[model samples]
Every structure is written in structure tokens, then in C-alpha cells.
Target: MATVKFNPKDILYHYCSTEAFHSIVTTHSIRLSSMSLSNDSMEGKMVEEALARLAECDKCDQGTISLLQAQFEVYLKDVDGFGFCLSKKRELLSQWRAYASDATGVAIGFSRDYLELLREEYLRQRDPFLGFTIAEVMYDPEDHEKQVRPLYQQIKHAIDEGDLLEAKKHSPLRSWSNDTETQRKKSCLASLGFSTLMATLAFAFVLKSEAFKEEDELRLLALINRGEIKKLGFDVKSNSLRPYREYELKKFDQCTPVIKEVILGPKHRSPISVVEDFLRCNGFGYVHVSRSAVPYQ
Candidate 1:
């Protein structure tokens, strides 16, 4: 459903600043930011909100509610999820305004097929611990509502007609209070419930605010263990350290380069040859470059 929805033949544009463009062309990689640390303060809240709506359970004791909320936050911070966002609209003004920084940047175009291959490669290796998915962002309410319904049903089944709030197996937030046989059963069921809820995260990552429907975003997201992240790199912006990992784009095995085209932003006053020369110098001679048709200054 991913490549089908986004169209593998379509070129996904990554709008970035001129400096970022230089870094990309030189390194042949893309940067992904942790979802929890994205510019949107509501980045990781959608799943929680959707679960509340679908469960329709009345509020429980303040202590119980706090525990589940804490668990959810722990899960997000436990396996840091990161996303590399791209737009199907090659020259969308909003993207140029948002990601193209200072109204003077470029949109680097990459092949959808190549990106898909990279995702498949990640899965193909069967690392078992690594998780990844590429998909078109869902902005429609009714459409995504249908997507989350099945998970809600599973949760309902797990609790057996008792609402999620009533299924309060809150023995302890982190571990069992005692090793009694009955307590062990409760702990097992609680683990099952949380793990089921975890399945909703992939959907959560690809769903975005409708106010941004114009961007028609597609995301290549990676969710990995916190232990592995400690050894990787991060980027600092706005005085905060964000976990990030770069995916290589340049192909060295005598295949077409993943980068296919580039569009100079409307206010990108650099000559067309600047991008062209860089591509050629970096062994990407087949890439096509053009100026943006938008009239924005």
C-alpha cells in the first residue's frame, strides 16, 4: 500500500536549505529527526488522542491514568522513532516556504524505487530488532479512522467487554509488586495490552495534521532500540539535541544514482549551473535540474 499510494515512479522532493543541499550532494545521504523532537509539539500525541477517542473509556483514578501515560512516554523515548519527510508535490509553495528555509533553497528529488529498495534491504537483513516502514501520509480523518479501528477492536477483545479503563491491571508501572501466581497473570495480560497498543505507532507516524494536507507528505521512518541509538549520531537545532541517522543515497555498484532531479526554489538566485556542476562533480551526471515555476519571492 505504500509505494502504490505514493507512486514509485513519482519523484519525492526533499526541500532543504542551500547549506543542507551542499551537505547532501557531498555525502549522498538524508537526515531524519526524532519524532518526539520534531518542530511539531504534537508530533507523538496523535496516537494517544486517537486511542482515547476510540476506547471511549471514562477517566480512571488519577494514579492509573498517570501510569499508562508514563508507559506510553517510556515507549516513545525507549525506541526513538525518526522520520525523513518528503513531498510528492515537487514545487508546493508551502514546502518551499517551510523546508526550503529563507525562501532560498532547493528541492532535491530522489527516486521512490530506490528508497523503497533501501527499506526492503533493512528488513531483508532480518535484524529482528530493527523496524522500518515507508508510506504516504494519511491526512483524511474518515480514512485514517478506518485504519485504526481494527486495533481498537483487538484491544476490546483483549479486555473481554471490560473497557480499557476497567482493565486496570495496575500492579506496578515498571514491574510486579509481588511474585504471586495471580499477580503474574495480571502482569502478562498488561504486557499483552501494551504490546498490542504499540502496533498503532506505525499508523501514528504517517498520520499528520490536516492543516498540512497541502504538502502531501511521504515518510521513511525508522524505529530502533534505544541501546543502538546511543552509538549513532545526532543533530543540534534550536538548542536541542535530536537523534538522527543518515541513509546513503549514492549507489556505487554501477546502477542509477538514487538522486534523480533538483528544483531551484523561486528565490534560489544561484545560477542553474551551480546545482548541475555539483551533481556532475559528485558522479551524478544523469540528474536533471530546473528552476521552480512558483512566483514566490
Candidate 2:
């Protein structure tokens, strides 16, 4: 892997001097590569996976960003004393400035210039309030905007287009390799998230069905009343039982029973348990003994 000359602190400062920046960076931290990427082969897959996660994160962070922005606006109003408030604000500003510097340094792995460019572009679009210190605003979510998604999509597109080597030209994280256990896990998780999202979307479209006849509608109504359709929503109580008819037509009805058996069965063969067992058996670490067993397997 290529050596990173930049510092994490500097990268942090360049991108995360504000609350919005901090939130965005931390979120990416959790959803993206938790460890540095190291393997060339896994880089493309990891990048694509990271992009999908970022999209989901963007959707979830919108509400948080708005709330943070509102707090920044109302902060002064809530302060009891001017001197105390100013002191607190100053302290926060200093902390954020330092934090931003540190994070920027860390992000130097992504290519210092690229990180800076992205940061500048994001800030240019956001134009956050300049009065408060960077530290004070690092957690506020309201300042986030559309740039996050577009940037993420750009990366994703690059990966899908078979530009793996070129895409990492600016990426800070190393690609995953078998030698680096951390990178492998991070890459695997990203792949899983990408696959899951794709499955959900495809399921929504491919499995779409409609209820056209009266008999079908009555059958749906009966299923809904019987609690076969868990939630009492539009899908269940539609006039023509369109939702029910559609759902039954989909593979979910056939697959759901099996899925539930795997998920809710006493054998404990659910995805979570499977993952836990795999990790434990593979020597990642041992988990506490549980009564759970996978009888199906």
C-alpha cells in the first residue's frame, strides 16, 4: 500500500470544523470502512458497498442535520448569562478547530488534496454560519445538504464502472486484502449492506402484483383479519385488496414463512446468530454460551 504523508488531524479540521462536518464524517466512519483498506482486489467492492451505506446514511441524517442547524440558531437564546455563554462558545470553538485539524490529518489517507477539494466544495455549497466556533457546531445535523449523496454516488459510480484502480487514486483507505483482517471485515460488511439494499429494492419491484378480482380481495381481507398480514395498513385494508393480492403474488408470501421459521424458530438459526457463530468459530473471538441452537441445520 502507498504511504500517506498527511496527518489525520489536518484532514479532520479541513472537513469537520463545523457540526455538520463532524456528523457527516463520523457517520461515514461508522458506515464506511472502519479500518483502512489495504487489498487491491477488495477496493472496488468496498467502495461500492460504502456508497450504498452512505446513501442510506444520508437519508437518515437529513432529520438530524436540520435539528442541529436549528440548535445553532437557538443556542444563544437558551444561554442564561452573556459571559458564561461566550466562554462556553469560545471553548467549544477551540475544541472543534483542533478536532477538525486532527480528522483532516487522518483523512490524508484519502489523498489530502482530494479531501480538501471535497471539503471546500461541500462548505461552498453549505455556507454555514461563521459566528460560532467549529468545535461548538461539530455535532449539529441541520447544516447537511445534497452534496453528501452526490459525492457518495460519484464514488459508487466509479466503482461500478470498473474504475477500481483509478477510483482509489484519491481514496484515503486502503483496499481490503486477505492479509489485513480488519480491512477484510470492513469490506465484507460493506458488501453485505450493498447486497441487502439491492435485494430490498429488487424485491419491491420484481415482486409487485395487483389485486383485480373480487375473490382475491376477499381472500386478502380474510388473511388480514387473521393477522397473516401483520400490520393493519393500506396494504391490508385496501378496497380491492390490491395490497394483499400484490403481496401474495410476490415471492414474499412463499419465502416469508421460511424466513420466519429461520428467524423466529427456537433453533436460533437467524442471521444474527449465524454471523455470531461464524465469527466465534473463526477465532475472531468467543461469544458467551447461549441455549440457542440451530435445529434446522
Candidate 3:
């Protein structure tokens, strides 16, 4: 095999949040623990076979692994923040468990049909907020606008009717919230306020149909094709991007175009410069980029 060289600075990293970084790390830690435990349970060939099977099951496609390694290299360049929200951690843990279960099932010679079933279950249980975030960054703004229009209308109608339950049902925090009626009402109102503000901003900046020139669209498509921009859990079909899998985005389904956050990475520019460039070039002011806190190993 030929030796390959890697230069960290040439990679672009993308992450949903600090919580997501922690989750990925935590899952790897647990897998390491399992490998160690297997050593004590079996000897020699048995242990080697077990380890090989585990490694095989844990393997991601080369393209994905390369992408992840590049992201981690960028992350290691700067590290900050130790704490993660409890809810986010739990949500990540659930996803980790599902992934582990599916991999293990396949390694143990489970039926291919069973593996497919597990895959479907895993998709159903993933974090919708993260999914939306990925979709927003990876997809064309026009494609995102189509996905969120119906959900936006629903949220507006629910708020206008003063139906807290209905409004909460359309919130991104729907699964995360377990508040009393008063608290739920307060949460609904807060979300409404934020949405209204975002709507105004979107109209002024993002929703102007003419804001994106033909050349700008071509530029974005080129970036995506060159892998400078990565879109997770979505695919381009018929010259438009759409979610490639099912996820929980019902609450923010309509507002995703207006509210989803975009991430800019140092691979494309120095940290200080990327933000300014993204805002100016993308024509949307809601882009987010990490400056100091890197939470991944």
C-alpha cells in the first residue's frame, strides 16, 4: 500500500453542537471499554476473532471516515468547554445505543432483513434538530424554503388561535419539553417571538427570491460537488436536495428554511475570516461558527 499524507488545515469540519461532539466521543469510549472487557472473556484466537468482528462492525465507509477524521483534526486545533446539557447528552446516548445495537446484530450473523429493520428503527429515533441543521447547511436555500413553508404556516395558525398545545406541537422542543401548562404556554410564546423575529429577518435577507443570482447557485453547486460543503442525511434528486431519511422535524418543518443554522469551517477560511465571508456571500445572517470551544477528540 502507498503511504498517504494528511494536512489538517486542508480539512473542513462540521458539527451540530458541543453536545454532538461529546456524544460521538462517548460512544467510542464505550466501544473501547467493550474491547477491553472481551480480552478477559476469551483467549488468543477467540479474542482476536471477536476483536476483528467488532472492528468490522464499527467500520464506517472510507469516505465517511475520512470526513470524520478531517473534522476531528480541525476540532483538535482548538479545545474548550467541558460541560454539556443533560438532555442533549441523553439524546445522543439513545442514538449511540441504537447504532451499537444494529452493528452488533449484523456482526452476530443476524438476518439481513433484521438488519434492515434495525436500520429503519435507528433512522426513526435520530435527533431531528441536528438533522435540520445538517440539511440547512448542505442543501440549497431554495430547496430548504420548500420544505419549511407548510410547517411555518401551521405554526402561525396555531399561535394566532392561542392554542398552546397546538403551537407546542409545532415547536422544535416538542420532544424535549415536559413543562406544566403555564410553562408550556410561556415556552410557546417565546418560540413565537423568536419565529416572528426570524420571519422579519428572512423576509429582509433570505426570502428575497432574487437575492441569489444564477452564478451564486452554480458556485454553491460546485462547492458541494468538490466536497467543500458537506450535506448529511440528504441527497440531490431532480436538481433539488431533499432529506434522504425520515426524522423528527414536524415542529420546525415549516420554519426550517428560516431558522436552521449554517456552520462555516476553517478549512475554507481562517476562523476569523470565514464568518464574515459566509455572511456576505450567503446573504443570510444566521450562520454559526465555533471560535474557541472545540469539544471533540
Candidate 4:
């Protein structure tokens, strides 16, 4: 076979986010610093002892630490200016590929199992008298609590009158609410027209529940007011909903180019192309592949 040459600088790569890229570099730098400190004559034993203690505190097994150390060495050798060389990039891509494959199966299985459990829970909590399902009550745009209050009042009246059997017979589970048809129709229309909007609102509710700092929430709110969130494809309707972490919001301001270079390996496709293909195959449509003009210094 003829001799082959490779140039590390010629390989093109991009990170999912600058923070992710920075984290990789910073972690490697920290490890390199630790290795240096532990190798020095005066601090060698002390540094090693400290590291061992810290590892023990973290509950890291020896095998895991050894594997991580080996990986870090490879990372230090192959990572370069805002990207990895071809070999390292390929290695990372392989890992991501494996994860992507496994994640698809796991996600499907989890969703199916969780949905069944949710349906069962809904049925169990449903009012026996109420003709409509609990899902309808939860998702109905109208004042559901107000609608259910009268039924509870009737049940209370029956119980107070010492007619326990009557109360049970007229229980929300046993009785059909008078407005079930109207409510059902409204729910159907809402599901048809505003399903995505409702889901987005629910996601915002979950994020707000995390109780992020007021300042962070205010910053995210400002971005919402400026229509930046809309630009990012989130249809956020309220300033109260802070749907992203501080670092995630910071990534929106980033304009780093996602380097796209031809791959020379067995799969002759660029890493970016491979990612695009994976996304498309998994039903992610038309991902934006952006490039920035800033030179890698």
C-alpha cells in the first residue's frame, strides 16, 4: 500500500454548543494541570492522596477513573482550535451515533409505558358519575374547577342529610354532568386547533416550577419581549415563563460557524452531514446549518 498523509488542521468540526466545546477543553486542561501537579517531586504524593480522596468522595470506581484518564489523554492529544482532528472527531461521532441509536429505542419504550400509566391514573381518579374523562377536565379551556363545584355541593348536601347511599349514587363518578356534550365538543376543538399551544404552555409551566433566580428569569423575560424566543422557534406567550437554563439562553447569542469538511474515512461523509442525516432520519426536518465569518484564532 502507498503511504498516506494527514493534516490535523485541515479537518473541520463543530460543537453542539460553544459551552459544550469549552467544557471539553476546560476539563482536559484541569486534568493536565492535575497530572502535572501530581508528577512534581515536592507535591507528588500529597497531590495523589488529595485526588484519591476526592475520587472516593465522588464514589468513582478505580476502573471508571482509569478509563476516564485514558480518554482524557486521547482528548488532549487530538483536540485542536475549536474542533477536533479527523480521528478524534470520528471517535466522538461513533459514540454519539451509538447513543442516538440507543436513545431512540429507549424513548419509544418509555413513552409507551408512561402513557399507559398516565391513562390508568386518569381513569382511577375520574368521577364515577361524570360521563367525560379526567383528561377532558384537565385540558378543557373553560373554568373546570368552577364547573365541578356544583357536583361536589350536591354530594355534600346528600351526605349531610344522612343519605350516604344517595350521595354515593349521585357521586360525580356515578352521575353524568349536564354539560358533558358541550365540554366534550370544546375539548375536541381545542385538541384540534390549540394542541401545540397548550403543550408549549405546559412546558413553560414545568420550567417555571424549577424556581430559577429572579435575575435569570428577568433576563429570559427580556429576550421573550424582544421576540428572540420566537426567532428560536418557541411560541412563548408570557414573560413569566423562563423555559431555558442560563447557559442555554447564552448559546442563542453565539454565532460560531458549524464547520463542515469532507470526511476521508470509510463513511466519506462530513460530521455535520452525518448529524443532519441522523436528524432527518429521526424525523427532524430541515435543520439550520449556520456558518460564522469569525476566524479561528
lDDT score at residue 295, model 1, on the 0-100 scale: 91
lDDT tens digits by residue: candidate 3, 67-132: 333322222223211111111121122222232232111000111222223234334654322221
* Clash counts for all predictions: 0, 38, 3, 7
Query: What is the clash count of model 4?
Result: 7
What's the lDDT of the predicted structure labeled candidate 4?
0.26
lDDT of 2 by residue, 45-81 (tens): 2222333345566563543333322322232122211
Query: lDDT of each structure?
Result: 0.70, 0.26, 0.27, 0.26
Candidate with more favorable, higher lDDT: 2 or 3: 3
Candidate 2, TM-score vs. the true structure?
0.16
Give the Å error, residue 101, model 4. Answer: 3.5
lDDT of 4 at 232: 27
Cα deviation at 248, candidate 4, in Å, is 6.9
Clash pairs, candidate 3, are 148-254, 151-254, 152-254
**Per-residue lDDT of candidate 1, residues 1-297 (tens digit):** 333333436688899899989988888777766877787887766655555555555444444445444445545666656788898887788888888895699998988877776776667665634435787888876665566666555554544534333335542465645657656555545555455556566676777778889989998887756667543577878798888877666353435357878999999988888778988998678677899999998
lDDT order of candidates, best first?
1, 3, 4, 2
Where is model 2 more than 4 Å wrong at Cα?
1-53, 57-138, 141-145, 165-297
